[model samples]
Target: MSAALMALTGHAEDRTAAAREWRAAAKPVVGYVGADVPVELLTAAGVLPLRLAGSPRADDGAGERYLGRGLDPAVRSILSRLLAGDYGQLDGLVVSRDCEASLRLFYAVRELRRIEPATALPPVQLVDVLHLPHHTTTRYVLAKVRQLRATLEGWVGHAIADADLTRAVVAHDRLRDLLTEVARLRRRQPARLTGTQALSVVAATTALPVERATELLQRLLAEAGSLPEAEGHRVFLTGSSHDSPDVYAALEAAGLLIVGEDHDWGDLLFHRRVGGSTELALAERYQHNGPSAARASIRRRAAHTAEAASACGARALLCYARRHDDGPPWDFPAQRAATGLPAVSLERQPYGALDIDARAVAARLRVTEEVAR
Candidate 1:
């Protein structure tokens, strides 16, 4: 492969090949459903949870035919490509009832393409997050996990014992340690990691097997650690799906590097697991992420956002709500007041068209950075 191709593939050039080995090492060959699903659970289950997403190169013709009029054309287009075979390689899929788009995506996956000739598309597991009340939702969630565990056991032809759970944690934690280093370097040094490159890190859980990802990550970490420190304005972002390295791309292009973030998909959610094989460790793993699929009272949503905002050290917070997303709406008011920091709210129609005006964000930060200097 060309050097350019190697870079795009990150640590492992042959993730598909690595995945086959991982599946052999693991049982059940599971795929997680939620963006917030703990990598530990799948690792422990001997499953590989690959995050599903849209990329510019993907074509969505067949996906459009699947969803019909259920979702908007843009969302359907993305789904068309994904279901049409974008992530057809995954053994099983985990679906979160997180938002309109995500929920719809889950539904479409379960309803359509329930079978494929090449491989079994992941069995869809619904995370019952109907947000009516805490107790009610929690019980539903716990039961769902049990069901998923049972399903996974059947797939593997054995059970996930305490030892298995603990072992998965060890392997996954090793991977997270590498990620944490990368995240810290991004903060302490600033911009060593980009938003796009960051997503590739998150994408690793599903895209490659544990052993190979760790090897690639080890190489990347050594290289990243040797890079020079980043000096400039540091901004914290709290939003959905900012893990794709666009932050690295955009901020680096403007001569600023993202030092920290409150985004749910990366550091915030990534830190939720460690050192436990107990059911509680597993349970807490799924519940504490920044956002959820359940419809909560407006108050709860704001609380979650305030958390991400305050915790992420955002000097300037960009609300990357995908045009009418409830997750961001719930967090807006509290997040606006959570920090003394200045904030920017950008409505995104999709990934390629982040309605955020680059000039506007840069102009605002430029003045602030100068003032700080």
Candidate 2:
């Protein structure tokens, strides 16, 4: 692969670099708080979809002061960065509820707007999407989706034509298809790439324009295809949306290749595609896909994770929970019992270096190593 292609897959590793690249494109970027925001809709509306993952090196002091320290560290970091003008150039921001911290982030940002408009927060919108697949849920979320579309239309001062949405869906669906191929490689007996590398690709795509991301992914897939297969204790990671590759890097360093993860930031986000190329079809498909942590029962969540682990040939399961991220703990017991795999769970501070938790890493390494023995 050429140097540019290599950089495309690894470039989002640095938040500053990613932001600079996006800004250089000079598009009207719409920052999102979580993975649930529909990139298709944003793209159709001529806005670049940017997920607001705070810089890995950011301190949570400003975020804690505004939103309280009780929030997840990653969430706090997002708040800190937004308040400090890290994403000041965004044309708008959309916050949705895939988790509690995201919802809280939305509210905090709204309050911040009222308290001080000079910080250049851009326009912010809250997308209240219902997570379950019930009839009422679909209807409610679809309406919200339309409302969100209308909100964006007003901002852009033009109607998003059906053709535009169709094109957007096709583009996003193609991107998802390529990512699925990457996931297939990750699931191989000896993984085709490290979990950190796989995730870096995912993270990079989220920050780039759809066409650019797709082009980069195609090159990445080609590059990974030529590499020798990896060798390690194959593991399935669960819990927490990892914005940085540190956790995956740490796990891989411990002789575990993360073959799969049940986090939204990983397999969950890329596993599914929009069923149809229309707005209504896209809305329905997304709402009914499966319940995220905020919407599903422990049993449902556990079942999903266990099945994914089994499908990926993971010999063990590991979960790393950040402080105040409560959903994972609730699902752990059932997930462990259901999977019947060697398991390790650990606690870490938000955005803290995952590899630095010596005890947790040691315990996880021990489990994988023992299993291999």
The model with the greatest lDDT is: 2
Task: Encode model 2's per-residue lDDT on 1-373: one tens digit a residue.
Answer: 4443467556676544655666687756788877678778999998878777866686779888988877788888888888777765777888887778889888888887888878667788887777675788878878878888998998878999989999999999899999898888888876777788778778878887889888877877767757667777788888777888777777677677889898777888877788787667777766765546656789998999889999999888887887788888788888888998878777554564664654456466566658757
Clashes of each: 22, 0
- Weakest ten-residue segment in model 1 by summed lDDT: 1-10
Q: Please, what is the TM-score per model? A: 0.77, 0.93
Q: Per-residue error at 184 for model 1, in Å? A: 1.1
Clashes of 1: 22
Deviation from native of the Cα of residue 77 in model 2, angstroms? 0.5
Q: Pick by TM-score: which candidate is best?
A: 2
Which ten-residue region of model 2 has the weakest summed lDDT?
A: 1-10
lDDT of each: 0.56, 0.78
* Runs in model 2 lying further than 4 Å from the true structure: 1-5, 15-26, 348-350, 355-373
